[model samples]
Every structure is written in C-alpha cells, then in structure tokens.
Target: MQVKDGLTFQEVNAACGVKIVAPDLEKSIAGTTLHLANTKEQIENAETAIREEWRAIYEKMPIMCSVCKEISPRVEFIANCQKGNPCQVQ
Candidate 1:
C-alpha cells in the first residue's frame, strides 16, 4: 500500500521480490537497512497537512475545565482514536 509519504511499499517489495513487515507507515523493512520508501510529493503533502492541523489547533483558545475552572493548553486533536490515546482532560 502507498504510504502518506507517497512511496508505495508494495511496489518496492515487488521490485525487490521480498516480503517484509512494516507495522508503521514509516518503518524500515525487515532485514533491510533501507526505509520503506518515500517520495518528495508525499513528504511535502504530509508536512503541509501537519502544519495546517497544528496551526488550526494552536490558534484555538485554551479549554477551561467546567469543574475545576483550570485552563488546559492547546494540544493536538485527533479525529481518530486509532492511536489509542485521545485528548486528555487534565
């Protein structure tokens, strides 16, 4: 499958005629020193999206706790909880 970095790990595997495990999108192939693969376009796109998302969150006001009246610093917001940890209330 193609990674966010625009490099097709599948294609690289096909070309090398080797099968490897890549748990994360940006991991090295098993028994290989080279990283999965990446393209300029993919890297740029990834960077742009990251910057945009960061900007959006950074520009927002601090979240105040309703119970404690404590203000929390702006933090990265995740739409998907796939990474396990979501935004903490602390």
Candidate 2:
C-alpha cells in the first residue's frame, strides 16, 4: 500500500519490516483511519469507494496525447465520438 516513487512490491514480511529504513512508515500507518473489517463485504465496500475517488481524479487529469504530441484532458480523450475539442485542434 506504500506508494512512492513508482516503487512496487507485492508483500512485506514482518521480519523484513525491521530491516527497512522508511522513517515515516510507522507514523503514516498509525495515522491512517482504521475500519474494523468484520466481513469480506466490508473490506470490498471501503476499497470500492477509495477506487472510485481515484478514478474521478484521474479523469480530470490532463496529459500529452501520444499521436499528436499535444496536451489533452482525460475527459476529452474519453469522449471518443463527441466533438468540441478542448485542445483546440481542428
């Protein structure tokens, strides 16, 4: 769950956790709002909300188009068929 600097890891073992040098790891984890997951559905419910929020954020994010090499908003890219280009290309 630690997302920093494009770094990716599947899982962290408790024994190896002691050897790692992340100063803020403990503080961050401690500060996180914890919810009691009494059932499988509860975990999925929380994760679903979190995923939706991130999806909305990514939708508004702007990026350069690969074909035209021009900046384009993600929403515009998603239009697919609709007109009125925001990037201003004719």
Candidate 3:
C-alpha cells in the first residue's frame, strides 16, 4: 500500500485506504480538484472554524506505534507491539 509517483489509481486508493465510486476516473480527478479549490476558498472564508474542525479530526485519527512510529491501523499496531514484532505496515 505504499504510495509513490507513477502509481495507478488503484494503487493510490489502496495506499490511502479509500475507494472511488465515480464512473469516470478522469472526470473524477477534475471534479475533485475543482471541489478542493472551492473548499479551500470556503475554508479561507472561515479559517478559524475550519482549522479547529481539522484539528479535532486529526486528533481523533489513529496514531502510529509509540515504539517505532510506523504507519498502521490501531489493532495491527497493538498486535505487533504485544508480539514484539517489528513495526511494519501491513
């Protein structure tokens, strides 16, 4: 699930742990860019509130392992830590 340059859409989605439901990938890309631009403008208009909301969301997200700081889901990370396994992304 490693995301790097020159990867396919599926690869990117796998890396990000998301799914695209759009019928057309190209149109989806364009629409997403446009939506992000619009959202950026809206956020600029309400920067304080948006920033606070984002901070709350970020704080609720799963954290990496305290031992090695590896990227993984919380359950897997705990299992690795309890088993004394190396911190690796599954």
Candidate 4:
C-alpha cells in the first residue's frame, strides 16, 4: 500500500484506498472479530454535549475590541460606533 500523509486508517478505508491482505493456507482458520464498545449514537451524543457546554460558557464571556482592547458586550461596542465614537488604539 502507498503511504499517505495526515490520514487516519479509517479515513483511508472510507476512501477505498486501503487493501485487506491475508496469507494463503492449506487449512481453514478462524477469522478475527472486532467489538465496538461505543455505538455511533453514543459518539454523536458526546459531541453534542460538549458543544452545548462550550456554548453556555461562551455566552457569558464579554467580547474584546481588537482596536482598543475594550471588554464589553458586542452590542455596546456597535452602539459606540453608531454614535460616531470609534475605538482609539494607542
């Protein structure tokens, strides 16, 4: 198989880039089995929970002006701009 950069085995397999190989034997042997402990639904639920937690934290945080280093809600900053008073960065 060809070596590719920055790709997981699952990604390559999904892209049909991987080839499964086995040895030729005279007698039959038992095949390997994989048991997935976490189902797809469990993984999705975990990701959703993480995103909700982060969103809750982000909502409480104040926004900082890139020009003046002022920390406040974004709406207040926009109001200042609307009043013809822009941030002055020294």
lDDT of each: 0.50, 0.59, 0.52, 0.57
* Candidate 1: tens digits of C-alpha lDDT, residues 27-61: 32233233323898877776676666656656564
- Cα lDDT tens digits, model 2, 1-90, are 764445345554444443344546564333233333558999898778656766777787887866567776688876842664434444
Q: Which one is best on TM-score?
A: 2
The lDDT, on a scale of 0 to 1, for candidate 3 is: 0.52
- State the number of backbone clashes in model 1: 0
| C-alpha TM-score for every candidate | 0.30, 0.40, 0.25, 0.33
Q: Write the per-residue lDDT of candidate 4 for residues 8-82, one digit (tens) a residue.
A: 354342525544444553332233222222788876876676567656655545778777888876566677779
1-90 per-residue lDDT for model 3 (tens digits): 854544235224232545444446663323212222247767676666555665565555576666666676556556667998847545
Cα miss at 79, model 2 (Å)? 1.8
List ranges where model 1 is wrong by over 4 Å.
1-37, 61-90
Over 4 Å off, model 4: 1-37, 66-69, 73-90
Error of 2 at 85 (Å): 6.2
What's model 2's lDDT at 66? 62
